[model samples]
Target: MKTFSMSPAAGERYVPVSCPVCGESRTREGWNCGSYRFARCIGCGHLYQNPQPHFDGLRARYGDDYFSYELENDANFFDLMLKGLQDAGFFELERKLGDRRRFLDIGCATGMLLAYLKNRDWRVQGVEICEPAARYGVEKRKVPIAVGTLDEAAFQDAAFSFVHFSHVIEHVPDPRAFLLEVNRVLEPGGYVITVTPNRAGLQARVFRERWRSSIADHLNLFSRRSLVRLLSECGFSPIGWKTWGGIAKGMAPNFVKAPLDRLAKLAGFGDVVLVVSQKISRKPQDPPVGPPDGAP
Candidate 1:
């Protein structure tokens, strides 16, 4: 739960940019946390960290301790993650995609989730950005992990039946390309489950500029509408959607958690969103008809 502070080095890495998901320029209303700025896109109504740390900046910031910070350097990290995955979103994927074929975890980090999936008879593979984190997964957790970015890994086309990631897409420099890569590796009718902090969630509304999810490292903060739109554009058709519930934790005393959550989730205002989508056919369209080759 420890948030990364925007250091002088990280700040130096910042270069002002526009919205990645939407090509439109950033709106005037935005908040500055230290020197970093989070802006909303006028076109898509999405919030993102403009002037975010580039790939090199991200690499410099993560270094060695980032994994330790993420793992909490705790012995029970895998155990804790297993329980949470089952209780949270894993079962939903399982129930939908009954047969477990090939599974790939993008930005798997220490491979806790991938390891758990392996236990369920899945042929699991992971791609991690940080070397230390990838090594930890391969060495200690006994998970098969590739050390590099998604584009660098070069997985085979239609190689995986299920591809998953939590809170990782927001960190990518180009989510559109990232998802297209994901679609490339995923088999036809494959399932993809993605989770990210929701910018249009209750907490974001309540906190406004002070929302915790609008942190330094998180580059894209998506709402359900924007996220689902991204998925459709990337060739994934959403089958199910649910917000990672925090209404019970963060709701005020006057608010009733259950009823509020039912309504809030439908309205796409949850702290996090768990989206289950199936990869649709992305084949090239046939050439337009004019006349026969000899006739025209």
Candidate 2:
């Protein structure tokens, strides 16, 4: 894995703009943390940090050090268990689809999920933007991966039976265009699954701006309603959905955290949202456009 170093910017820059989901321009607000400032659209309730870095900039951030940190600090026994649960979710998705011959995983970091799917006899292919990560997948795991963005990757249309984007949508610049491309490359009855942070979750309410998930990389925030609406607009039918899992479960906590963890999981407000939808031949009607005054 290669690492590229670059000088940090002296200050943050803000760009005022209307809401992308809705055309309301009146309720834009600024989110400031130290020297960083983000222009959040109150209209559609989308929070985006300012001075968004380009693809190369992101690649530099995800170098060897980043993976080392993830492996050392993030990936543990509990993390492994959580990953198993996530793979179980995908397994259920596979059953629903009734077949799993081909699978495409976008933003497949280190190709762990693809490796898991491959074990299930699904031919796994992945598209990753970071060079080091893609190389690791190809060389270490022997997973076939296209080392680039989805739009730039060379894959035939309708090549995949299952397309997945776990925790990847928020990092994308254009969610609609991304999904449109997903639809283009998917077979007529293929399934598309996405998992991302739900802005409307209880964690968001408790942590507010300081929520760990509210970071510089997440350009879009989607609540359950908003996510469903966006998927419908992009021509996917909602088939299955699940909400939050406890953070304490990832930590070696005693009995004190157990009850709270159970409650949080029951409330479906942990920290992440998973959605499974299938691609259909007919396009669904667009969601009713909200008012221009930020009234959702």
Question: In model 1, which runs have C-alpha deviations exceeding 4 angstroms?
Answer: 1-11, 73-100, 247-268, 282-296
lDDT of 1 by residue, 1-296 (tens): 32444353724566676766656775555666766777766665667777667778776666676777766743454554454456456677677667756899887888887887789888999998878889988999999999888888999999999998877887877787888899999988898888887776787777766777777777887776677777877888888777744464544553677777667766766777778788899653322232211100
Q: Over the full model, what C-alpha lDDT does candidate 1 score relative to the true structure?
A: 0.73
- The candidate that achieves the highest lDDT relative to the unseen native structure: 1
* Highest TM-score model number: 1
TM-score of 2: 0.81
Per-candidate TM vs. native? 0.82, 0.81
Clashing residue pairs, candidate 1? none
Per-model lDDT: 0.73, 0.67
Across 192-239, the per-residue lDDT of candidate 2 in tens digits comes to 888887666766666656656666666666766677777888888878
Error of 2 at 172 (Å): 1.1
Candidate 2: stretches off by over 4 Å: 1-18, 23-26, 70-89, 96-100, 246-253, 288-296
Clashes of each: 0, 0
Instruction: Report lDDT (Cα) of residue 212, candidate 1.
Output: 74
